[model samples]
Target: MINDKVLAIILGGGQGSRLHPLTEERSKPAVPIAGKYRLVDIPISNCINSNIKRMFVLTQFNSASLNRHIKDTYHFSFFSSAFVDVLAAEQTPENKGWFQGTADAVRQSMHHLLRHEFEYVLILSGDQLYQMDYDLMIKAHIKNKAKISIATIPVNAKDATSFGILKADDKNLVTSFVEKPDTSLLPEWNSDVSNEMKAQGRNYLASMGIYIFNKDLLIDLMSNPDTIDFGKEIIPQSIHEHKTLSYQYEGYWTDIGNIDSFFEANIGLTADIPEFDLYNKSKRIYTRARMLPTTKVSGTTLNKTVIAEGCIISAAKIEQSVIGIRSRIGDESTIINTYMMGSDYYQTLDDVNNSKINIIGIGARCFIKNAILDKNCCIGNDVRINGGNHLEDTETKTYAIKDGIVVIKKGAVIPNGFVL
Candidate 1:
C-alpha cells in the first residue's frame, strides 16, 4: 500500500552539455553506461528494487532513444498497475517554455502526475549512479512527520564544496542549507554524521539531489512559479517554513555530470571490487532483455575486463576494459583502459564483405587505450589512439578529446592508419 501511494518523477537533466559528444545524439538518460546499461537504467532500477513501480521520466532534448529504451525494456504484468513512462516537454497555453530547472521540470509535468493517486512524490536524478532503497526514506519521512525529505550523503570538505550542503539537528531535521558553499564556510556547515563518515573525514552532509515531498506540499510549491530550482530556491527557502527530514545514505553514489565522470564510472566497473556492485542479486539493474548470444573470445588475454553479450574478441590483450554487446575486436589488436560500447546490430555478412574501408568494429593490429568507442563505430586497421594528459582538448567530426580521453562519436568511421 505504501508503494502504491508513492509516485516517482525522474529528472533527465537539461542540455547535458557537459557530456557533449555522448549527449549529442541522445539525452543524458539515454547515454549508454557500463557497456550495456543506459544512464537512466540506474535510477529506474533503483526505483523498481525499492518497489516504487510507477514513474515518469521527464526529458526534453533528443529523447527518442530514451523513449524507445523505456518502451522496450520496462513491461510489468498486464494486470498490474506498474509502468514506466517518458514525458517530454510539451507546450500548453499556460506554460510555453522549456524546463528552466529541476523544480520547473516537475512543475511543468505536475498535471500529468496529479492524475495518479500518490501520497508521497519521490524525485530522483537521471544521471546518478547508486542503489538506494527509497522505502526506508519514505518510512523515515512518515515517522518524522516531515513535509519534505532529502537524501543526504556525508562527503569530505573537498567534495562538499561542490554540492548543496545541509546542516541537520540531532533529530535529523535539516536546519540550514547552502548551495556549493565555499571551502572556508565548511567548518560551520558540519552536520551530525555517522562516526565512520567522520573517521573518513566526511563531516558535511551533502544533498544527493534526491528528495521526497508530500503530494500536497509539492502541489502547493508548484503554484509558486518563481522558484524554478529546488537546490537554489525551494530548499533553502522552505527548510525554515516546513519540517524537512535529512535521511543519511552512506553508499557508493556518483553524479555522472560530465564526460570524465561518465568515463570513470564505466571504467571503474572493471575493478576487482567495484564500488557500484553490478553483481548484487538483490539489487539487480534492469535493462532491455536482448536475447544476445554468449560472448566468444579467442587468443585474448583478459585481465580485469567485463565483456557483455554477443562479442567476438580476438585481441592480443585487453586489460581493465569493458566490451559491450555485439562488439568485434580484430586479432592482434590491444585494448587497454577503454570502454567500447558495442554496436546496436551486427553487420550482415554481405555488408561486411562488401565494405571497402572499414567494418563496424575495430580492425586488426590496432591499439586503443584510455578511450571510448561509441556504438556502431568503424575503426580501420593499424589505428593507434592513446588518450592522456599530453593531448589537448579538441573535437573533430569523428571523435573528441576531453580530459585526455578520446571519445569516438557514434557511428564514426576512422580510416586505416589513423593516429590520435
Candidate 2:
C-alpha cells in the first residue's frame, strides 16, 4: 500500500449545466463515461491503483446515483480499513449554504476530514480521463516541501485556452495562474515548454485541477469564510502566498467538462490506437461489475465500436461509436460517429412479443449520425438524426442540438418518420 500519510478527496462539482441531459438525473460524477464506468470511477480507480486506501467524494447536487454506485461497486473486506464513501452536502449549524464551489465543498466537509490522521490531502477532479500514480505526485510534493502542489500537463497554445494556464519559475515553483485564459492572450502566457514536451509539439502548461495540499495548510486556507473556489479564488491567491509547486504530467489528461470534450473522449476511445488506453493490464480502470449475459450480434457490420455487455445487435451498421450495456439495434439501421448510453435494464423477448414496454435502441431502418443518444431512449422506424447537415444549436421538446451535436434527451421518444 502507498504511505498512510495521504488522503484523497474527489470534487464532484456543482450543477453540471454544460453536460446537461446526462446530468439531468444524476450528479456529474455519476454520469456514465466510456460506456461502462462513471466519471467518479477514474479518480477512485487512480487512488486504488496508487495504493491509497481512503477516498471521500464530495457531492452536492443529485448524488443519489453516485452514492448507490459507490456503495454497490466498492466493497472492501470488513477487515480492511480502506473505504470509498460519498460525503454529500449537509446543512450544519455553522454552514447552511450549499457548496459554492470546489474549495467550499471541501471546506464544508473538513469536519470529517479532520478526524483522520493524514499529512497531505490530495484533491482530484471527478470528471477527467487519465491514469495516474498519485503516490509519485505525493513523493514529489514531499520532496519539494510544498504547501500545495498543482499537477500540470504540457499542451500546445491552441489547446491551452480552455484550461487554467499556469507559469512556473526556474525551480518549478508556481509563479502565476490564470483560469480559462482568452484565446487571443495565449501567446503572451506561453511559458517554457519542456524539451521533451516541445518535441511532442507542446508549448504551454495547463492545470489538471489535481492538487496535493499539506493538511494543516489546507485547513488554514479554508478557514477563511469567504473562499468559494480553489481554481478561481484560492489557487490564484496561493501562488504568491504559499509554497505552491508545479508537478508535470506527460500522459494523456483531458477535462471532460462539456459536451464537445465528452463526445470526443468517448469517440476517441474507439480509435485503432487510442491516446488513453483502457486495455492497459497493470493500471486498470475499475467499475461496477454487472452480472450480465454476453453480447449477441447477428449479421451486423461493426467498425471500431465498443459495445458493452448484454447488447443484442441485429443486422445494423455501427462505426466509431460507443454503445452502452443492454442496447438493442434493429435491422438495417445505420449508426455512425455516435455515442449511445445504453439502457439500465433489458426488455425480454416475452415483453417485446407482448408489446409491454418500449425497448431502448434504434428501430428498424433508422439513420443516426454524429449524435449522442442518452439512456432509455426509443427511436421509431425510419427516424433520421443526422447532425452533419446542421451546425447551429436547436432546442425542441424532444431533442436538443448543443455544440453541433444532436442529443436526444433521456427517455425521449421519437415517433416514426421523424427527421432532424
Candidate 3:
C-alpha cells in the first residue's frame, strides 16, 4: 500500500482480438491459460499474495465469462470493508462512452473508487503471467515517498523497440520515455554490444504496465480529463514535477498478448529448468482451489507435463503438454505438444483402438501434433488430424482441415474414425 491506503483496480476491459477463436466467446482475462488457470487469475493471485484484499476488476468487452468466473471463484465475505468486485462500464451523465484506454477505464470507475478513503491505488494489467511480491514494492514506495512507481524490466535492444522503453537517472528518477522506438534511430549505450545493438541502448527498462499511484494524485490526474494513459501521457507529463520512481523487476513476466506468446509461455512450463516456477513455496500463486482428487497417470509414458488435480490418464503417451483437472484419456491415444482443459465428464474408451489419431476431451482418440485443442471437444477414433507435416503453417486442408490443428469449438462432437 502506498501512503497507507490499499486499493487496487485491475484493467481487464480489452477485447483481446489477437487471441481470435479463444476470445470469440469470452473476454481476454477470462481466457484459459496453461489449461488450468485463466489470465485474470495471475493478477488477482498476486494481489492476494501481496495481502491486498480490496480489488475491483474493471471490464467492458465480453465480460460474461470473466464476471461468472470471478463470482464462482473469488468469494471473500469475511471482511466487510475489504472485498473483490467487478465493475462494468455504465452510462453516466458526464461520460457517454466506453473506456478508450487504460487511464479511461480508471476514470470511468472514479465515481465509486475516488470517493473511498485510500492512500495508494494500484493499477495492473490482467493479461500478464508473473509472480511478484507487491508488498516489497509498496514498502519501497513508502520509503522513497514517491507519488507514483512504475514496475520496469530490462529488455534487449531489439525487444526495447517493441515496448514502452523507459530511461532512469542514477537516482532512479525517470529521464526519458518512448513507445516502440525505431531501431535505426537508437543510440548505443553499452560499449561491449554497441555494434551488435541495432536499436537504442543495450540495457533499457520497459514498462510492465503495473503502477502504484498516490490516491490523491490519481484522482487529481483523472479529474483533469486531459491525461490519456499512464505510459502515453500521465507519467511522462509529470516526470519532472512529481517524484515518479522506477521499480526494477528481474523475474518471469510475459504479456501473453498474441497467440505465439501465449503458446510459448505454456510450453515453457515443460522446460527442464523453467524460468517461472509455479511450485515456489515462499511466494504461493493463489487460484480457485479445486477439490478434485489427484491426477492418476496409468501405464502412459509421459514427459515434461503439468497435470492438475482429478485427472485419470489411461494407457496413452503425453509429451511436453499441460492437462487440466478431471480430464480422461482413453487407451492407446497419443497426445503430443498440446494443451487440454479439464472437465468431470466421463465416457467409455476401452473399445478405442487408435494410436496415430490424437484425441482432446473425454473418450476422444485424437492423434495431433503441434495443435491447440479447445475445451470440451470430442474426437473420434482413427481420426488422423494431420493438418500439415510442416510445423510453420497453422492451416491444414489435406484432411479437409482449415488449420494446422483441427479446432473443435466448445461442446463439439467428432464422429468415430472421422478425419478432419
Candidate 4:
C-alpha cells in the first residue's frame, strides 16, 4: 500500500573532535549555523523542500540538544503522513557497542530500517553546508538503473586532498574511489572524465559523501560483520559488484569538520557576496520557531552583520559577525569577524540580579575579534579576546585556542579584566 520509495538517513553524533569546544556539550549536527539554525536543519529542510517526507537522524554522542531540536522543530501536521524521527544508538544483546563508523551506524539500525517500506536509502552528512534537491539524484538513479549513486563535486588539486576522490566514466558511472587522496594519487584528466567535469588542469571529482542506494543492495552490503565505514570500505568494494553512478553537484558545498574550516565558513557569510545563499525564498532553510521578539540595537555601529531576534546591543562597534539569539552586549564593546551564540533562554533583570552564576552576555569595554562565543557564556567587563595573532595552542580548563581561533566554551564564566 505504500507508494514512496526513498528513505533519508542523516548521520549525526560523529565525535566532531576536530570541532572541539563547539561539540563538547552537543552533537555535531546540533551545532548552530547562520546564527539562527542548527546544522541538522540544512538536511531536514532539503528533504522537506524536495518533498521527501520520511527521515531518520542517527545519533550517539551528546545527543540531548540534538534530540530536543529534532522533536520540537519537525512535528508533522496531523493531516499529513510525513514524519522526522531520531534513531539513537542503543546497546542490544546482539550488539553491545557504540556506532563504530558511518556504515556501522546504519547497520545497527537495520532492524528498524527493514521494518519500513522503502525501495532506496539516501545517506546524508549532518555537518555539510549546502542546499540540494535529492529528488533529482533519485530520478537519475532510476534512469540509469544504478544500484548506488554518489553525489560529487569538482575541486582543484589543492582542495582535493581533504575529500574522497572518485573516477567516473563519460556515462557518469563510478569506477574507483580514494579517500583523502594525496595529490600524487589524484587522477589526471583522461578520456573517462566527463565533459561537464572539465577536469583538465588541476580539477578532480571529489566525493561529497552523499549517497543513494537500492534498498536490497544496501541491506546486503551491510550484512557483513566487518564493514565499518562507507568511504573506507563499502563503496570501494561495491565498484566490482554493482552499478554505482555519480551525481555531479555544482553547488556551493562545504564540510565544516575542523575548527579552522568552521570559522572560515561562518565568517565567509558576512562577505559582500557570500558563496552560499541563505536568502532563497522558493526553497528556504527551516528551523525551530522560538517566538522571540525583535532584536534591539542602540548607538551601535553595525556593518555587514546578521543579528538574530531577542538580542540587545548598546554603543558597540560590530562588523562582519553573526550575533545569535538573546545576546546582550554592553556599551563600548567591539566585535569583529566573530560568531556569538547567544543564550537558550532569556535572562530578565531579576534573574541577572539574583543569580551569582554567569548570565549570558558580553560585559562593557570588551573587545572580541576572530573568535567564537558559545551559548550561555558570561564574558566580564574589560576582557580582551584577540585571537588574530595567537598562533600557539592553549587549553585552559574553561576555554581553548584551536587553529588560532579563541573558542569560549559553553557556559564558561570569564572574570573581569582578563586578557587572552
Query: Compared with the true structure, what per-residue lDDT tens digits does model 1 show for residues 202-258?
Result: 999999999999999999999999999999999999999999999999999999999
Please provide TM-scores, in order, for all candidate models, with all chains considered together: 0.99, 0.96, 0.87, 0.95
For model 1 the local lDDT of residue 121 reads 95
Clashing pairs in 1: none
C-alpha lDDT values of all predictions: 0.94, 0.89, 0.74, 0.87
Q: How good is model 1 by TM-score?
A: 0.99
- Per-model C-alpha RMSD: 0.8, 1.5, 4.6, 2.1
Candidate 4, after superposition: displacement of residue 4 in Å? 2.1
lDDT of 3 at 217: 87
**Higher-lDDT candidate among 2 and 4?**
2
Please provide, for model 3 over 89-173, each residue's C-alpha lDDT reduced to its tens digit, 9 standing for 90 to 100.
8899988988888898899899889667889998999888899988888887878899999898777777777788777777676
Better of 1 and 3 by TM-score: 1
Best by TM-score: 1
C-alpha lDDT of residue 75 in model 1: 95
Give the range where candidate 4 is weakest over 10 consecutive residues by summed lDDT.
187-196
Number of the top lDDT candidate: 1
Instruction: Please report the TM-score between candidate 3 and the true structure.
Output: 0.87
Ranking by lDDT: 1, 2, 4, 3
Task: Please list the residue runs of candidate 1 whose C-alpha ends up more than 4 Å from where it truly belongs after superposition.
Answer: none
